[model samples]
Structure formats: C-alpha cells, structure tokens
Target: MTTSDVMQDVLGVILGGGQGTRLYPLTQKRSKPAVPLAGKYRLIDIPISNCLNAGIEKIAILTQFNSVSLHRHIYRTYRRDMFTEGWVEILAAQQTLQGNLWYQGTADAVRQQLTEIQRSNAKYVLILAGDHLYQMDYREFVRYHIETEADITLAVQPVEAKLAAGLGIVKRNSDGQIVEFCEKPDLDALDELESMPDSDKPFMASMGIYVFSMEMLAELLASPGNDFGKDIITGVLSERRVMGYVFDGYWADIGTIRRFYEANLEMVSPTRPFDLNNARRPIYTHPRFLPPCEVYGAKLDQVLLTDGCRIYDAEITNAVIGLRSIIGSKVVIKDSVIMGADYYESEEDRTKNRQLGRPDVGIGEGSVIAGALIDKNARIGKRVQIRNLSDRPDETHQNWAARDGLIVVPKSAAIPDETVI
Candidate 1:
C-alpha cells in the first residue's frame, strides 16, 4: 500500500491509569495526568492537544486511580457533546471476569473497554501514555502504519544509550522495520549495542505511542498476558511485521517529579523544547472565569501566571502560578509547579481552599525559595529559608524534607507568622 492509499479511520486512546507513584506528593492528591502543567493546563492536555492538532477527534481517556481530577478536567475543558462529528469519553474501570480489582496492566485496561472501541467503528487504534509531554502529528504515524500495511506500528526516537536502557529498546532493520524489541536490557548489552556504530542503524527507542490494527489489538487483548510491552508486544515483535516510525520531535515523558520541574522550566527558556505557538490547531483546556493575573510588588521575569493570581512582594522566576493563587509579601517561588485549588479541593469548599493559597512554610517576611515545589493553601511564616542544592543526579524522584533543605508543606497546613519552617 502507498502512503496516499493508507487506511485512515484511527481512534486515539490514552492510558491514564498509572498511580504515578514516582511523582510522590504531587500525585499524592491527583493522578499523573491530572497534574498541572505550564500553570494553566494539566498533563493530560498535552496528548489531547496533540490529537486535536493532528486532526484526530475521537479519543478515549482510560483512567482509574484518583480519576476525579482527570475526569473533572476533561469535563470542564473538552466539550465532546459540542462536537457534531466525533466524541471524547472517559472509560473507568469496572469489575470483570479477570478480577474485581482495577486494571491489571496497560493491555487489560484496553480489554475492559473493548465494547467502547467497537462502538467507535475505528479501523486503527492509536495507544498513548497520558503522562508524556510532547507535540506531534499522529496523522503522519497513522499514514506510515497504513502505508507499511503492518500489523502494528510504533513511534520511536533516539535517546542517550544510558537512558534508552530504561525504556523499551528497538532494533530495526535497514528498511526501518522492527527486528527485535526488548524492555530495559542490562547496561552491558546496551553498551554492546551502542559500541557498534552502524552507519544506517538508528538507536530507536519507543515513545509509548503505537498504532495497531483493530484485529491485531483485539487478538492481543484476548491473549493471556500481564503487560503489552513485556509480554504481548515483545512476543509479536519477533514474529509479525511491526514497523517503527522514526520521530525527532521534542518528547518528554514527565513521569518523575524532577523531570516535571525541568519540563516546565523549559518553557521559560529563550527557545522552548515544545512549541506552544502553533496556531493551526490550538490546545484546548477549561475556561476560567477569573480576571487577568494581577502583578503587585513582585520582580517577575519569563513566568507564566494564570488568571486571578495576585503576586505580592515576591520573586517569581521561571515558574507557573495556578489560578486565583495569592503570593504573599517577600515570598519567592522559583522553578517549580503550583497546582490550582480546584483540582485538590471539593466543590463545596473551594472558596476556602482559594483563601488558603499562600506560603505555608514559615518563611519570614524576607525569605527565599529556590528550586522548590509548594502545595496549595500552605502558609509560610516569615524568614523561612528553603533552598537545598543537594540533589542526586541519577535519581529523578525525591521527597521534600527539611534535612534535604527542601521543606514541603502540605495543602491547607497553617504556619504562624515569623516562625521558621
């Protein structure tokens, strides 16, 4: 089949079920996908926006753990009902013959929602991870899948050999067809692959984005398997004709807290990794009723603040402030993320949450906070210094502690003024 004649009816499915345990306190209240990004948008918005920009409207977000925030964000932001031609729906977990518990793995989640997929009448199924942050046109991938006439197609990119070992590694032939796929091979073998510098070979790594024939997906889902990557996908890769679509776009799986922080900081850079200036298809999110952000006595540079936020005498550099959040005098918020109160608070008492959105740590009237993450509704007392430079380079996940010099105050925690945190 030629690229021009490739099949076209593709349905986008986002797997948003992971507990996001790696993200700790951030995911402590909401799912990874529900985590706020660039101050105003949630992590899920990235993929949904990609789909929208790619011209794929029919999407299903499969979620489970702490899905309230994810569901609410989708409901408030995306209007599936408004679309006359397509739809976007959320599929939650339910009891099944497999078990009464939640989804077993990635494959199981899709299996549970087979009925919904059937109803969509989609010829191709595009599976994606909701926690990833990237901007790409999946239409090109779909076109590649149809042109190759393969059973499955995967979107892949090259990463540092050390980093690629942690993700699924693909060995492709000269024709760019997947020859072998392995998940997290040992460092020695990875080094061996890296040592052999093939002129035509590319260090293709899986982006956790896939396109599968409906028949192939159904067959794989019905088969007994604990995971798609470890069991089904690897099992099939060695047998069937699986193709790899090489991608060089900016892709970052915001799976860890530090990565999340780094990804946001990228936005403030002179040249951002991800392009937000695309006007062909704009990213959509929930509408806010609050007034524009009000900047008071603050020294701000290259920061993105949402509506109804008041920045007092504080230094906010390369950070994102959520909606209706109040920055107190001399409070410093730098290189971190602040989630909106609506995501963590109940509907009845959101005003209360809004009222508590300030420094929770006992940062004095003139304190400095650098490279820190503050939860909503925290009261930081005057003169509280929270700048810790001791961080492990190898680990992407870490907890906040006074010993580490990064004091994290939980939401709604009150700290008396002038008290040190």
Candidate 2:
C-alpha cells in the first residue's frame, strides 16, 4: 500500500483512562497521560507524536480520570489547522441513556467508544497506551500486520529473564505467529513461555500495542470483556490468526514511581537509548512561548533545563529542570526531576502568597532536594530538606510523600521552611 493508502486505512486509538494508582501524587491532579515528562513534554505526547510522525492523523484519545488537563493539552497542542482531513480527538467516558457505566479496562474503554470508532472510515485500528515512553514508526508496524495478513498483531519487545514475569509473555513461532500468551506469569510459567533461544533476552513481552482489522476488533468487542491482555487476547488466540511484531527499541512503561523516576533520569544520560532530540520525529507538546532559561552562578552537570527557568547560585547534577522553574540561591538538587511551574508567578501573586504566609512558586534558598520528583508549581521554602533518608518504600506527610525511597512533592504543594523528610 502507498503511504497515503496506509494513512487513510489506519485509525489510531490511544487509551488514556487508567487511574494511575502507582504514580499517585503526580496523578493526584492530572491523569497519567497528563503527567509531565523529560522536563517538558507530557506522557501522552509520545504516542500522539508517533502516530503523527507515521502519518496516522485521525486519532482518538480515550480519557476518564482527571482528564481536564489532558483535554487542555490535547486541544492546545494538536491544532486542526496543521493537517488536511486530519484530527486528534478525545473520547471521554460519559453516561448515556443506554448505560451509565465507566471504563472498566483497556478493551472496555474502546468498547464504550465503539460507535465513534466505527464512524471512522478506516480498515484497521491501532490501539496504543498513553503513558509509555518510546518512539515507534506505526507505519512499519501496520505494514507488517498487512504483510502477515493477521486479524490481530501485538507489538512485543524482548526483555531480560528477570523482567519477563511482570509482563504478558507471548510465544510465537518463526513466522511471527503467536502460539501462546500469559499476562503477569510466575517464574515457572515464564520459563515455559520463553520464545527466544540464543539471545540473552529470551522472553517476548507484550508492549500493550496492537493493530487489528476493524472487523475483527469490532467482533471481539462484541463479547463481554474488560481488558485486552486478560480477556480478548487470551480468548482469541485459539480462533484468530494472531501475530507478533518484535520492537527492538527503547521502550519503558512508566507505570510505577520507581520506573517513572528512573525514566526521567535516563533522559539526562549521555548515552541513552531513547533520544528526544531526533529532528526527524520530534515529540510535540503544548507550546509555551516563555523566555530562555537563565542560569546565574549555578554549578550544573548533565542537566536538562527547559524554557523559562531561573537558577541562581545553586548546585545541580543529573537533574531535569522543567519549564518555568525558579531555583533560589544556595540550593542543592541532585538526581531529581523538578516538573517546574505551570506559569510564572507575577510580583502581585508573590506578594499575595507572602501575605497568606506561603512561599513563592518554586524551590527556595538553601533547600536540599535529592532523589526526588517535585511536581508542577510546588513551593519549597528556605532550608527545606526532602531526601528519603530511611529508604522507606512508602510514606505520606502533609503535602509531600515518599515512594520507593524517592521524595515526591505533589503539584502546588507547599513545604514550610527548614522542614525535613
């Protein structure tokens, strides 16, 4: 098929309705897809940009929990003027006269929006997860599905033996035909389902990405099932011609707090697998025309400083300073992900905050923040310390919390001066 033909035949459906219980505090005010990433972009941008880069334009994002910010970001970033007969639309969970139920799982989310999906004039449907970080050419994936003549094609990744049990393991023959599948199998079950023989990475893990013939997908959704992994994929393996497409690229599911923190830190590494700097397929986001970031007498190493940041007499290393961040003098931040402020606080706003006995909108002077994630618009007062010293797996304070030994200050939270965690 020609590029135009492929573009016309494929519809991209992004599932963005998960509760994100693992990434709490960060997800306290926003959905998982709306969570900030790489100092600037939201997690949802990864999938949308991939679809746009692959020439798949008519996309639908399914959102449910805390969807206001996600909706705002989508509308602002993906403008209709940018494409011809192309659109990035949102399908939020709603209560209709027929039913008043919410999305129960991935498959159920799409099932609820089946009417809208059927309205699109596309032969195949490409379903993607919104919170995963990776760059993939969906055109190649779709072409592979067509070549295999598959009713359903799941994108799988080779993972180390240690990590195989946590994912859905797929066993495929040499022809890429999926023979067996198991979700979150035990060690013994994973041992039985190993697909690769010679390589160090012997287990094929599902990426939660699938391409399906429109007819097949509609028929599958007609049944009573909630999840694709736990329901549809498992049930249809015996009946349908299911295939697997191996993806040999940088892909990280930022589901848990540790994974989320590690993924953000990986972006600042000198030699990382995922490169956001690729001009050929750049990640798109809501454009904030803020001024350039300014660093004044600050010591920095391997830091990603986005636009509209002001650093003064601070020390930072292996950190990501997000947009519109303000770091005061004598501050020390290391191995941290500061999500930065949504908007710069005006002088009047600062005065009002002071009157209300609140610190300004960013990190304050002499504060030491290490191994942490400071969400957007947080206020850390002077001499505050936020290192998870006890290495506790989980703890919750007034406005701050610790998960997996990493301190997390939720969005717009205020920490008092000289407070220690």
Candidate 3:
C-alpha cells in the first residue's frame, strides 16, 4: 500500500469503555476518559485532539460505563463544520447480532462497533486509548505503516525495567520488525532477549496506540479474542508482520490514582514532559466558557489552575485546580489536585463552617496542607486540619498514602471545619 492509500480514508477509533477502577473515587461518577485533566481538559480529549491535529477527520469514540458526561462534552465541543466530511462521532454499544450486553473487553468494544466502522469505507484504522496524556500526529504513524507495509504498527516508549512490567515489551529485529512480544513479563523473563537495550535504563514499554489495516482488524476480531492487548495482539505478534514505532515523546498512562495525581502535579513545572503548545500537534479538550482565573492576595507558583477559579489570600504551590473552584480566605493548598464544582451542606445553608465547594473545605481559617488531592463538589469545614503524613511511623490511618506522601480524599466527602487532627 502506498502512503496515499493508507491516508485516503483513515478512520480513528478511541477505546474509552474501561471501568477506570484504579482511579476509584475519582471515577466514582465519571468514566476514566471523562476525568478532568490539567483542570481544563478531559482525559479523552487528548486522543481526539491528536486526531484533529493530525488532519484526520473521521473518528469514532467507543464508550460505556457512565458515558453520559463524556458524550455530552464531546457533542457540545466538537459538533461543528469539521465533522461534516469524515466527522467525529460517538459509538455506544447497541443491540446487535452478537449480543446486547456492554463491551466485553478492548477488542470486543471495537468489534461491537464494527457496523459503524465499516461505514467509513476507510482502508486504515487507528486504535487509541482515551485515558492517556500526550500528543502525536497519527499521519506520521500512518505514513510509516504504509512505507513498511506491515500488518500492524505499535507505538512504544522506553521505560525503566521495573515500570515496563505493567506494559507489553516488543522485541524487534534490526529492521524494526517486531519478532516477539510479551505482555506484563516477569522480572526474570527479560534476560533471554539479546537485542534488549543494555543500559543503566530499562527496556521499551507499549503505548497502547496501534495502526491496523481495516481488513486485518476485521480478520483478527473474527478469529476469537476477548481483549486487545491480551488476546488479539499477542496471538499474532509472532505469526504476522508487526512493527514497533519507538516513541520518545512525553506519554503517561493515567491508570492508577497515584499516577493520575502525579501526572497532574508534573504540569505545574515550567517545563513538562508533554508540551501542549507545540503547533505540530496540539492536544484538545472540551471548551470552558468561564473567564480567566483570578488570584488576589494568593501566592501561586508552579501551579495550573483553570479559568473561573477564585483564590483569595491562599498559598498554592505545585497543584492542579479544575474550573469554577473557589479558594477561600487565608487557606493554604500545596501540592494537590482539586477538581472543580460547588456543593452544599444544605442547599439553603452557607457559612464559614457550612459553605460548600472546593475552598469550602475550611482550614480553620489558617491551616496547612501538603501533598493531597481534593476531589470536586466537596464540603470541607473551616479550621479543619488534614495532612498527607503522620509524625508517628507506627500509626495506622484509614487513608491511603502514597510512597511519596500524597494523600487522597474521596470525592464529595463532607469534611467539617474546626476539626483538627
């Protein structure tokens, strides 16, 4: 196939149906893809933005598990002239010949939406994940696939050996053709590979982004597979021609709570692994109508607070605050992730100790917090004290504390003010 052949009618499909169980309370009400990102975007927006930036207009978002918010956001933000040609659309599971149940797995999710995909009449299909933060031009990957004429092309990155355990490892020949692939290999299993890069750093990690010929995806799906990475991809790794596209760009799998918070905090730095300003490929998210964030008598440094957020005499450092959140007087929020929105102790009640919202979690009018994540729509009391750590190493707490001392507060929890530890 020539470059033009692959690019002639490219179809973009995003797998956004996962339960996001790892994110727990954050995913309590919303799907993983709908989770707030950088206080201004949703996780799903990253891949959609990549598609638009790549000049690929034909797209389908496959979603399940509390997808209303995800659907609404996509519809509201992207329903425009751009989608008229090979437009962007949402493909939810409906009653079909196979079954009426929800998606069984990643592969099944796509397979279930075969009818919608087939309508595109596209020669190539790009499968993507909605729970990641990165920017890549799919056109480049498509061009590479056409040049190599490989059955499949996978995007991979080099990560530490320990971290690679959770991801699939690709073993490629000198020509970049993948010979063998391992999904979540044990620590001792890597010693057998001769081509594995021998360095202080570890081996490569799978980015979960794939470019597949429409025929190949259809054939693979028909051959009996439950999941994408675990079943279909691995089953064909050794039998068919598969190539690995080693990606050196910024990428993070927001699969867990700690990872989700860490990724948000990383953005507070002046220089981040992922640069959103790159004109070559820009990231996308839902648009917010709120005005610019206002900070008055607040000390903010190395923080990313979205628009419509109000900060009053608060000291915030190294944090990511979502839209429409408010920080009250003389409060200090440090190294945390705060999703926006307001709530109330009582719909008719509002007081220093009774106010509801992000800043409503009162800090005793003067309290300190470090390394914590406060979810959206929470009511916190004034003069209340909460920290990520305890001075006594032997003490046991109900909260889950990360190895780096980050504390997580469940979403929508009512924290009374003047409550001290």
Query: What TM-score does each of the candidates earn?
Result: 0.87, 0.98, 0.89
Q: Per-residue CA lDDT of candidate 2, range 1-421, in tens?
A: 5966887889999999578989998999899999999989999999999998999979999999999999999999998884488889999999998679989999999999999998997888999999999999898899999988999999999999889888899998899999999998988777778788888998899999999988999999999899998899999899999999999999999999989999999989989778988999999999888998899999999998899999999999999999999999999999999999989899999999989989999999999999899999999999999886544868787799888888999999999898887
Q: Which structure among the candidates has the greatest lDDT?
A: 2
Worst 10 residues of 2 by lDDT: 388-397
Q: If both were scored by TM-score, which would come out higher, candidate 1 or candidate 2?
A: 2
**Can you tell me which runs of candidate 2 are displaced by over 4 Å?**
none
Minimal lDDT window, size 10, model 1:
394-403
Write the residue-wise lDDT of candidate 1 on 1-421 in tens digits.
Answer: 5432332367889999578877766777788898878767888998898887776778899999988978988987888665356678999987877568788888888888888887888888999999998888787889888788888888988777658777888877767788777788787777444322553333678888889988889988888886777777888876788898988888898877677777888876768977766797576788877767777778988786777776678887887776666666877777655544543234545456346643332233666667666666555556666554655232232323332334444454555444443
For residues 12-125, write the lDDT of model 3, one tens digit per residue. 999985788777667777899988888778898899888887777888999888899899989987886843675779998788776998899889889888878988998889
Q: Whole-model Cα lDDT per candidate?
A: 0.73, 0.92, 0.76
lDDT measured at residue 64 in model 1 versus the true structure, 0 to 100: 94
Model with the higher lDDT, candidate 1 or 2 = 2
Clash count list over all predictions: 17, 0, 8
Ranking by lDDT: 2, 3, 1
Q: How close is each model in CA RMSD to the real structure?
A: 4.3, 1.1, 3.5
Better of 1 and 3 by TM-score: 3
Instruction: Extract clashing residue pairs from model 3.
Output: 361-380, 363-383, 364-382, 364-383, 381-416, 381-417, 382-417, 382-418
Error of 3 at 192 (Å): 2.3
